[model samples]
Target: MAFLRPLGDTGLTISALGLGTVKIGRDQGVKYPDAFTIPDDQAVRELLALARELDINLIDTAPAYGRSEERLGQLLTGRQDWVIVSKVGEEFENGKSRFDFTPEHTIASVERSLRRLNTDYLDCVLIHSDGNDLEVLRQGTLEALAELKRKGLIRAIGVSTKTVEGGLETLRRADVAMVTYNLAHDQERPVIDYAAEHGKGILIKKAFASGHLQAGHADPVQASLDRILGTAGVGAVIAGTVNPKHLRENVEKARRAVGDL
Candidate 1:
């Protein structure tokens, strides 16, 4: 089985590998290595079922990921059994991306996410950093998220940081941190270490470098999981694959990675 780990002191446990929902919603303006057709509704339902059968409990989504949140709300059967992680600060509209981190936007975004996701509250909410991490943290965004948590609208709060300083600040101020750490780019390992030492949750993004490393390697998926999950602070790695076979493969790799640890 895929290992389940605690999301710091947030009182939530997440699978070591999460199913990312970006491809299920949006296919425009994406940086994927290759273009692919989006799957239909039945296909998505099967994928979610497969994820549950494989012991995957975390589903990563955001308002920026087109219609992902709504789709999850419609397709997911056992809402109480899974941990849903969404983001604020970024919104996708008409094939374009925009960011807002003000307190007003932060609170309003969480409320909208609740409505779209068909949930009373969110398991985790992150600041979708627009490469200005420090400024966002200082602009009462995290404070607003904290307020939501106080109101029982969110369980944990954090930022998807882009820089080392931002990751450090996230650790200082938030309950978790989403960072990019993989073989090609490991500049955020220090942030992982800090999270480990401090008992803060760490979620990995771009673990396979947006699928650019899929080709030209003997077993890139396993290699990537071994490296990232073997790290101390990582609570989960968000891997978005609509293919059921690939999803199982990733979960198998995650099991192996944790077993090796």
Candidate 2:
């Protein structure tokens, strides 16, 4: 089994490495108009099974990544031990996407997410704050999250913020906060420091910088990972992997990164 890291002061423990499902559903290649396609269901199932076998218990997905939640629902039906963290804020219509954070939309999104994820409740519900402003973060959506928590729809609340400042604002209220801190985006250090100072549970995203850091060179990726592990209060590093071997390799790398700390 891989090492289980604590989620800040929260008692929940998760694998240091998580499985992200964007590539599984979206286009796989470098081009935009003709992105890569998802593999067959059997292939996806094999990858998911391999993840479980390797003890990766946190599976992070978003409805924004075309049909990923549905696929994950189908794949994770029997296994209830894993932590399923899904995001809300994007609405898909006629194959197009729109962003909405109104309270009504948020409630509806959670309902749809529950249905698509095939679960009674989510382990974590992040207010997918992409381009969402401070007032939205402070007023209506925050109330919605508290309501959802009150209603038992999610065990914990989180926000996936791109900027460290945005994450820090959310961190002031959320039980968990997911931030994009990797070699390519090392500017998030101050936010990481703030979260550490407050003892907020932190989940580091983009640790591999969307495959750039993993291109066989230690250059920036390894250094950034080392820095994050050395940081005061980072909880777990969430780097998605479809390949089982790569998943194991990531866990080993994380262990090494945290070893000297």
TM agreement with the true structure for every prediction: 0.97, 0.86
Tens-place lDDT per residue, model 2, 20-113, is 8876766532223333457778878888777777677888888777778888778774557788888888655565667788888888888888
Please give, for residues 3-107, the per-residue lDDT of candidate 1 as tens digits. 998988789999999999999999999989788778899999999999999899999999999999989888888989899999999999999999999999999
C-alpha-based local distance difference test score of model 2: 0.73
Q: Candidate 2 at 181: error in angstroms?
A: 1.0
Query: What ranges in model 2 sit over 4 Å off?
Result: 28-36, 92-96, 214-221
In candidate 2, the residue pairs with backbone N, CA or C atoms under 3 Å apart (3 or more residues apart, or in different chains) clash, namely 27-36, 28-36
lDDT scores of the candidates, listed in order: 0.92, 0.73
Q: C-alpha displacement of 11 in model 2, angstroms?
A: 3.4
